[model samples]
Target: MDDLNAIATLLTKPEPPAEAVTRSRGRLQDRMRGRARRRIGWLLPALTLATAAAAAVAMLVTGVITPAGAPASGREVLLMAAVSAERTPQGSGTYWYVTREMRDMDIPRQESWTTRDGRRWSKGEPGDPPGVVVPDPDPLMLKGAEVSIEDLEKLPADPEALKARLAGLQGRDSAMTASEQRGDPLFSLITLISELPTPPEVRSAAFRALATMPGVESTGAVEGGHELRFPYPDTTWEVKLVVDPETARVTRTNSLSGNDGSVLLSAGFIRVTTGWTDQPPR
Candidate 1:
């Protein structure tokens, strides 16, 4: 079995030593940070591939699984996120507004805002204009022909049925190769659910749906909050969702490259403030 599968199998067995968990988490975090600092472009591909292989071996030796059948750790986390999302007050407004700060390895700090009605505004740097609406299609990209806020609201809350519908939609994308289409269904579903301006129930259902996917793993608690990770499509990097257990809402989503332990991308709304104001963000 691979590292992930080994961890899953071990999770079904007995708990590893607390020391082992610490070691595993430390190794993963350290490796990610080290990769982020390196700037050599050509060596990255080889380094990433080698890193993924080494990580699998490290997982096996570290024995990172919790007690088997003791309730999946990831499922519990997701359930909590679902409940938190359900309780979160959806602001009353003609349009939904989200503001967030983004940081990457070499990129300067950027602040941005997005509206549910498909408008994007941003500030380039600290001294730049606070807000200027940019003509961009990214917000609309969140809603496809079949999957929209309206469509998501109609989706069944049942996990299995919801997963199946997401799978069916995968084939509708004519641009993807057959191999890509056959990749992880949960990835697409989660991406769509996370980005779209869906109802609270729909958002809740999405988390609940993810709880049912096999091989999902929980990293217990990290610096900001609890983390639940899912394997990505043909990549060593994992898709990580950081949830504030106290509030049960996802604070951030990260594409963590396993090879160099660097983050490929991170996205989330830092604050969502909505009201009946027709004026655009100033």
Candidate 2:
């Protein structure tokens, strides 16, 4: 159709012979061509404007805006497209959780628990007293049990040394025998070990720790800053960690990408602005 239009435009350029114009209904044909050109000229802008508007609407709805500089207060914000989950202060030192499930990934399942650090735990191990369950537990299950951040600190100060210990621990364990398996403490230990700023020798161990995590992938640095990317059932998300450079303690975080690659649902990013506070969410 475009080709035909182009040809018609070329043919009508000089309006044909004026003497040949009145011959054999040429005048009528010329009139039809003139009317067609006028109609096409009007339609083009309307279509272009409509296309631009649709693109703008899609961007707004997807939340794919360029993020601003990282926040200051050691507070963290995590977003999965328009849906997001945040850990904030409920009061001076206490924390709370707020999550918006825009994609319905079944993340806030009935089997959920809370950690002392204020993060929500879903799919815990058996008899484990309901903590976070590392979802993917193949090749590296049977580890001892979960432990706390403080407990991990009690272990070796060397990250490399600690990782070796973790590998050995996970190797001896077997699959859960019952619901009690859900409460295993290794998940907590894994979290602690992965988040800590360990020596280079232990960096591989941190990656290994993150690998055994049910839904977590890699925890490392990106663009010269620390980053953690985790996989939800339907989406994989990236987060930039905000840390106290001196303490190696993560102060806050920002979401990098939502739905980087997944089979289910819309695979795209949404943009949002957030602020973190020292206090916890209520």
Question: Which candidate has the top score in lDDT?
Answer: 1
lDDT of 2 by residue, 199-252 (tens): 322332233233343444223222212234343322244332322121222333
Q: Candidate 1, residue 256: CA error in Å?
A: 11
The best candidate by TM-score is 1
**How well does candidate 2 match the true structure in TM-score terms?**
0.25
Q: Put down candidate 1 lDDT per residue, 91-164, tens digits, no spaces.
A: 45544444333433443434344554446554443345434444333332311233334565686655556666
lDDT of 2 at 44: 17
Q: Give the worst 10-residue stretch by lDDT in candidate 2.
A: 77-86
Residue 146's lDDT in candidate 1 = 34
For each candidate, the alpha-carbon lDDT, in order, equals 0.48, 0.28
The clash count of every prediction, one per candidate, is 3, 39
